[model samples]
Target: MKLYSGIDLHSTNSYLAIIDGKGKRIFHEKLPNDITTIVQRLELFAGTLQGVGQHRGCDREKA
Candidate 1:
């Protein structure tokens, strides 16, 4: 099954989500904002993952 991932990145943590081609969520979690942790998690699905995307934005107050 082909998989896709999206990450909502913040200052201290990030929300990771993976979905199948039919748009069913297979995995979702909140993880620390560390590259190693993220990479390791993604590696689990490397065989089937098609791509990964991330979104980072500033807070209204900070912007």
Candidate 2:
């Protein structure tokens, strides 16, 4: 079963989501901005994950 993940990154926290090939949400959670924790959580799907896509929040100030 192929899996895919998407991450919404923020300054203090991030949202992680994993979905199966059929578009069924398998896991979802909000985690801190820690690489170790994120990697640990995603390790379970390492073998089946097709790719991980990340979207970072843009907090740029208007000039």
Candidate 3:
């Protein structure tokens, strides 16, 4: 199974969302703007995570 993630980054916090290929939401959380914290949160999804679709402010891109 393939999983996808979307991250909405902000000044002090960020919104992270994960979903399966069928668009079923798997995880959602608000996290601090720290790499370690974000990494820890993402670790929960680990090996199954395939790609990331990030929307930072007005810029839309894949990361």
All candidates: TM-score: 0.89, 0.90, 0.84
Using TM-score as the measure, name the better of candidate 2 and candidate 3. Answer: 2
> What is the lDDT, from 0 to 100, of the residue 27 in candidate 1?
98
lDDT of candidate 1 over 2-48, digit per residue (tens): 99999999999999999999999999999999999999999999899
Q: Which portions of model 3 miss their true places by more than 4 Å?
A: 59-63
Query: What TM value does model 3 have?
Result: 0.84
- 1-63: candidate 3 lDDT, tens digit per residue: 789999999989999999999999999999999989988988888899998888888756988
Q: What is the lDDT of candidate 3?
A: 0.91
Query: At residue 56, what lDDT does model 2 achieve?
Result: 93
lDDT of 2 by residue, 16-46 (tens): 9999989999999999999999999999898
> What's the TM for model 2?
0.90
Q: Which regions in candidate 2 have their CA more than 4 angstroms from the true location?
A: none
Query: Each candidate's lDDT (Cα)?
Result: 0.96, 0.96, 0.91
